[model samples]
Target chain A: MTTYTFEPRLGTDRTALYVEVQQFYARQVRLLDDLRAEEFAATFTADGVFAPSPGLPPAHGREAIAAALRAAHARRFGTEPVRSRHWYNMLRVDPGPDGTLVTHYYTLVMVSRPWDPAPVIAPSSVVEDVLVYEDGELRTRERRITPDHQSF
Target chain B: MTTYTFEPRLGTDRTALYVEVQQFYARQVRLLDDLRAEEFAATFTADGVFAPSPGLPPAHGREAIAAALRAAHARRFGTEPVRSRHWYNMLRVDPGPDGTLVTHYYTLVMVSRPWDPAPVIAPSSVVEDVLVYEDGELRTRERRITPDHQSF
Candidate 1:
């Protein structure tokens, strides 16, 4: 068993920091559910990385992340009354010694199709994210999403 | 969006406490993987509650929790060469105002069947747990397990 430890700088308000980190994730999920892929990618740093799964290649940089997100949601985005929604919750935030924040949560993806009365849900994914606060704004440095089911 | 706020006592060693909490969870997963159902239930307080899914009645008390765990794993527990293994990861631990720990994580359950060379994985579940330290030992107060796929 490996023991993990962290020592935040003196006078750091951990409680407040935790709240801010949660809010950031809330906003990120909202952007994706609202079909704002560009905005969702902007939540990451300029040189951020996004991995959809463990064995897949990651998308590097803001532009690449945006492109990948768009491709993933192309079907929903192309249809009328976009119905894809992402629910993220139970976030745990940890501050790193090197000015980074690591957090993890489970995300549920649902879609409401025209033929259905309500949303059809998909299996959830666990997301592990590394973030950095730059210029008074928190941005993701890397996000690794591991889904329950493997398509490929 | 709602903002959650909690203020722990000013002099607590949160980082060290966090490590202890993680170790507790690690021990819990290990117990389950090793077919220690009774021991796993012992990790909870005497009056603990374990809920397998949303909208389901929770198993109350240590004895009941133990019974429920045994029932859930009956197939594997009764068979020879037990193949059930639980992989829990991406834990987030938080301290409550009244000396409790709230944590969440995604769990991947896999089974190594005699017919297959690789393990067959089940859909992940996100678990939310509340724990408290009693008599100098950490024990679970409540546990809620939410599976990714809902069977209607």
Candidate 2:
């Protein structure tokens, strides 16, 4: 198997830019990991939207997305010991008319519980998240997580 | 509902570049539609690789991918109709070490038979294809379809 070198910013010395985006993703993941719902919801813009795509539940606005995340987090943490990793594989950052358009790809992830040598659910694929940055902060201009692979 | 656009070549001419890319994509799709395995496979570089994430089959190398397409065509032909519209979306072509790192998202497909819609499967997001230009013609270096939306 091939491994990816986590460059994060992909060699862009736009240190703040990299960290800004990183922190946003980090915060989102951490909120889920820590089970911090309010904090998680606060990260989104007032009008932030989450559209899983046609035929799927599309939670629009920060409050709606936050609520969905809360329920999902509950289910995820309820059963699983909550060990997981969200890795950014391929990232493309561009200047948009409104803010910085950041397209990030999540390559691989492992979610396992204690006493389990293998992961309960390990995803081997990439997910692209399109984000927008404003006022030196990050918000979901759009987050499109494309599935490179999927397992039950 | 909202919409998205794709761009692979930058600054040179999105119009002409899109037309060029469209031609290649069209040819491949049409060739595949025709069930001509060899010609369909000819769209890629000999070393072209297919990376299908889980819940999907993986086809690597020109010959193997071609064979997979042939089999897939056999199954899909009677069920679906090839799209005439160019559904390429979020196409961003970047310079790679060997060639252009082409990333694009596509899911809007043409329906051949309304009675049976083709199963929404792998590459659940965007069709991320790596392209190389030879003799002013473009061929896939590697094509990885990542889908943002998924079905079972």
Candidate 3:
């Protein structure tokens, strides 16, 4: 028999903070998936750092982030018509220093072609993020993503 | 240029209720994925109704729900070892009559084998659920799943 272990539910559940974070991601992810690079990058702090994977250099700021996204988007979809959706699950929210919020969640990217019956799953990953309120809106200050196989 | 449209965010954001509902699904989906049929069904009310797909007949109660899950699990995993994960996204929660909570969200099933580099995505689906407090805990009273292709 295969034994399954449950992932730990981290931190105390803060209702207001949780809802606010969810709403933030709801808008942010759509921007990324829709290839709205500038809009997506705007959700980050001016000096935000995005280390998409351990092997790649982190994008340093909003301008770099948008450029990186645009380059990736053109490379992937330039050859064919495809749509991708980002899915998030098992979110953990905790309070950080200086009134910031720390969050961890699993992200799955599903890609589908016009003729495909279903989207194909990309390698699953977990993201660690530090968020702070900037002008009364939550913005990501730092984000580090680790693919499942690379996680300890 | 292909026009991209965003799904509407439904209902007012209710922090306590949203967190409660997410925690409920976090526990519930694990049970289902682990093939703990009895425990999975127990998350539903005794008279819960599960309409898995529009074309399939609904499982009328908890017992039937358990049985259906067991049968499906056996058939799928009997020949080969496979792991499936359920991912939920874009949740919409609303208050219902009589203090019930209604939820709508997208569900994606990703299936992987021991040798596969990454999981394969199954057809995407949307779930509509009505939940109520049972014994001080939230329980699903009705769940209706509709595949994206079948949805209007």
Top TM-score prediction, candidate number: 1
Query: Best DockQ goes to which candidate?
Result: 3
- Number of the top-ranking candidate, with lDDT as the measure: 3
Model 1 segments more than 4 A misplaced:
A1-11, A75-81, B1-43, B46-67, B75-131, B135-138, B141-152
- List, residue by residue over B26-114, the lDDT tens digit for candidate 3: 99999999889889899998888889888889997889999988877777678678888998887767677676788877788888999
Deviating ranges (above 4 Å) for candidate 3: A1-13, A150-152, B1-13, B20-87, B92-104, B110-120, B125-152
Question: How well is each residue in A46-70 modelled by candidate 2, as lDDT tens digits?
Answer: 6665654333576767677777776
Q: For model 1, what is the alpha-carbon lDDT of residue A6? A: 31
lDDT tens readout by residue for model 3, A90-144: 8998877766788999988877665454877787999999987776677998899
Off by over 4 Å in 2: A1-23, A52-54, A76-80, A122-128, A148-152, B1-152
Per-residue lDDT of candidate 1, residues B1-152 (tens digit): 11223234433766656656655665576576556878998998878889998867899988898888887777444654545546677888887656677899888775554434344567689999987876667788889999988634
iRMS per model, in Å, is: 8.6, 12.8, 3.5
Docking class of 1: incorrect
Cα-lDDT of candidate 3: 0.79
TM-score of each: 0.59, 0.43, 0.58
Model 2 local distance difference test score: 0.53
Report the C-alpha lDDT of model 2 over B8-84, residue by residue, as the tens digit: 33345544454456446645654653467777677777777776444576776678987887666556564444422
